[model samples]
Target: MRLTHFRHSCVLVEMSDTRVLFDPGTFSQGFEGLTGLDAIVVTHQHPDHIDPVRIGALVDANPDAQLFADPTTAAARGDRWIAAVPGHDYGIGNLIARAVGGVHAVIHPDMPTIDNTSILLGDEERIGRFYHPGDALFVPDVPVDVLGLPVNAPWCRISETIDFFRAVSPTVAVPIHDELLSPEGAAIYLARLTDMRPDGADLLRWEAEATQEF
Candidate 1:
């Protein structure tokens, strides 16, 4: 599998002869002009996660690609969007995806928790399994070959962030959701991962927009 990180949480996972784009949001933009994607998976409805208007335009541009979203996003987008059902597997082209998680991490006590879904995509032996947990540090129950870790966010602390890696136990960890960080801050977060990642798991170090093969 090949993973390419965009500006923030937006990542393009190329596996099994398929290109799956996750979270093409306001922080990310290159995907809009691309075509022939196998699937576009949105984990939630937050602007940083969904970017409805921009995604809508991308959908219009790439009619052949399938749009999979969590309930809230699917509902708002109407029939065109397919709701990602928890525990249900979706076969789109060469990729098979399973939806995980139900709600976004709460921003604060006063703020209501919003709907969210983390997607695990891969086939029986295709690039192992890759999970992209949108805004939250959701760890899938199954084995993960590559984990899209949210390095920094409002709802997570450095300790909980490390705990997430421990729980999932992915073979390779990749940092995401880092658009808000300065170069120095990102370096600190990367150092934390280096110092505390689970045993035997490799952390891929690549700049944004660079590709890493697993």
Candidate 2:
């Protein structure tokens, strides 16, 4: 599979002549005017994960693209947006997309937690399994090949992130949800994750707008 990192949590996955885009949010770029998308997935209602200002145009451009989002976001968006319920499977071209993680991480005691639907995509044989957990540290029971790891977030600490990484134990770890970090700051997080990574596991540095094979 080939994966392209746009910005922050946005990623484009292409495999078996199918293209799927995830999290076209406010912090993301280079996703505008994209065509031939098989599906567009949003993990939550937050503007950082799904931009209200630009999503309409994106949908307009890809009218045939299947829209998937968290229950709250799907209900509010329209009929075209299907709710990504946990344990349910949706076919996307040659792959199956399954939703997991029902709730977002707790920001604080006073703030209400929202829905976060982390997705797992794989083929029929379950090869090339890729997991993308939007704003949550959801560890799947199944084995994963590639993991989109959120390196920084307000609700989580570095220790928590490390633990989640160890739990998932993917073959490859790709950092996402890192719009808040500077180059040096991101390097710090990456270094720690690399040091604490599972034995023989690889951590990748994906360049924006460039597709890297996993």
Candidate 3:
């Protein structure tokens, strides 16, 4: 599988001859050369997580691509898109996906409308999970190959991120949701990840415009 970090929480995952774009927000870039997107997954309705304008552009570019999102997000699309919920599994071509519930944060208990999810994608032989926690801080029990975790959000403290990393224990933990932070903040957070892991989980940092193959 190939993973490309566009910016902020937006990521493009390519596997099984399919390209799945996750959380194409307003600030995300690097979609100029992308074509034939098989699926688009939106974790929530947050402005930094879902940009209908960009999604419309993507759909216009790839007519066959399907959109999978929660109920609120699907309604925002105003089209006949696929509706997905926690624990639901669906298959598209060679890619199989399972949805898991996630949290928005500890501070926003009143705004539960912003639902979050983690997507697991793979086949029978080898399973690969990409946990896009959206604005969530909860750590799931399931094991994952690659975890796209939010390192710094408005509601998350540095200690909270460390605790999340310790609980999830993913093979490779890539930091996201740190766009508003300074370069020094990111560096410090990365360094903290290096020191906090008890099992020495692989720390992967995604560059704004770079892509990594798993």
Candidate 4:
């Protein structure tokens, strides 16, 4: 599998002859003009997770790509958007995307939690699995090969971030959902996360917009 981080939470995963992009939000870049994608998966409806302004253009460009998002976002994002319900699987090329989490993390007590489905991509033969948890910390039952870790967020703290990384224990964990942090702040967070990551798990930070094989 190949992974490309496009700033913030947006990432492009190429595996099993399929190209799938996750969370082309307001903070992400370089995904607007992508074509020939097998699927576009959105974990939640937050503006940072799904840019309402530029998403139409992206969808228009990849007309053949399947659109998948949480139920509410799917219902509102035209008829083509499919809801990623928990326990359900969506086929994308040679991989199967299984939806796990059904709710987003709470930003605050007063704010209502929304739908957030963590998508796990794996082939039928069980070769490898790539997990994108979006904005939630929900862990899947199966082992993960690569993890898109949300290192910083409004609803997340450094301790929770460390715990999540440890719990997942993926072979590789890459930081995501980090648009709010400055370079220095990101360095601090990354250092801590790297230091506390589980044994045998590598914390990798791929260069933005560049693809690297995993």
Candidate 5:
């Protein structure tokens, strides 16, 4: 599969002719040229993960492309969105996606936690399993081939991020939700994370506007 990282949590996962877009938030750019998208998987309703106006435009443009997200996100988007059922697989072209992770990570005692939906894309054999755990640290029960890892976020810590990576031990880790720091800073942190990987997993540096195949 080929992965195109625009910015932040937006990564277009393309396998052959079928393409699935994740996030497409305010922090993520490079949408002017995006066309023929098969599916858009929104992990949460946070502005950095899903921009309603921007996504509405995209959805309008790509009328055939489906919008899958958590209940909160679906509700926020009204009739245009489809809420994902946890553990239930939905077919998107050649790929099958199962929703996982329900609630968002705790920000603080006073702040309200929102809905977060992490998705796993693959078949039963897990040959091309790709997991994108939106804004939280979600550890899937099965083996993963490609993982979209959040390097930095308000609810994420480096220690927990490292632990999540260690737990999943994916063959390739794709950094996401990282518009808060410069490219240099993100690289430095990822380099350190590479050294600390438990399974010697490859930290694929997803460059903006470039398509990377794995």
Candidate 6:
């Protein structure tokens, strides 16, 4: 699979001639050039994670592309797209996705109402997973190959980020929701992870302009 990181939480996953775009948001770029999108996976309804207008444009461009999002997010759009329920699995083309529930933050315990989700992709064996935790901080029970975590997630401290990595134990960890910091800040965070936990995980500091294969 090929992964391209745009600004903020947006990521483009290419597999088997199908492109799956996750968390299409306002800060994201390069959507204009995307083709053959099998589906769009949205984790929540936050402005940074889900831009309704931009998503509408994407749907307009790719009429055949299905949308998989949380119930609230899907209701907000009020369109004929598929709604992704927590703990349910759905398939689109070669991608199979399962939603894992998580908390957005510790402060507002019940306001968000399970808006965050961790999506699991791939088949039963030799699965390649992509997790977008949104603004959540908990690790699910499932295994993950590539974990997309919010590095400096709003309302959570740096310690929360560290604890999340330790729990998830993914092979490759990519930092997301970090538009407020510089590229060097992301590097420093990864470096600290190396020193703190040598056996922890590999941090994939995604550059907006670069493309990566997993």
Error of 1 at 76 (Å): 0.3
In model 2, the clashing pairs are none
Worst 10 residues of 1 by lDDT: 120-129
Name the runs in model 5 displaced over 4 angstroms: none
Q: Report the number of backbone clashes for model 4.
A: 0
Report the number of backbone clashes for model 5.
0
Q: What TM-score, computed on C-alpha atoms, does each candidate reach? A: 0.95, 0.97, 0.91, 0.97, 0.94, 0.89
Off by over 4 Å in 4: none
lDDT of every model, 2 decimals: 0.84, 0.91, 0.76, 0.90, 0.84, 0.74
Write the residue-wise lDDT of candidate 6 on 1-214 in tens digits.
7888887888888876667888888777776567678898887777788875677778878888888877777887777666787678787787777777744565565554556666777665634477777767757787778888777755767777777787888888877788877778877766776555426468876678568888
User: Against the correct fold, how does model 2 do in TM-score?
Assistant: 0.97
64-88: candidate 4 lDDT, tens digit per residue:
9999999999998777999999999
The local lDDT score (0 to 100) that residue 53 gets in candidate 4 is 96
Model 1 agreement with the true structure over 1-214: per-residue lDDT tens digits: 8888876889998887998899998887566687888888899987787676788777877788888999888988886789997778898788789887878987899998988888889886753389998877777767888998888888888898899988888998888888788999999998998799999887777786888888
RMSD of 5: 1.5
User: Residue by residue across 116-190, what tens digits does model 2's lDDT show?
Assistant: 999999987873388999989988888999999999999889999999999999999899998899999999999
* Model 6: residues with Cα > 4 Å off, grouped in runs: 107-114, 126-128, 197-200
RMSD of candidates 1 onward, in order? 1.5, 1.1, 1.9, 1.1, 1.5, 2.1
Report the C-alpha lDDT of model 5 over 62-114, residue by residue, as the tens digit: 88888899888888777768898677778888888888888888878799988
CA deviation > 4 Å runs, candidate 3:
109-113, 126-128
- Ten-residue region with minimum lDDT total, candidate 2: 205-214
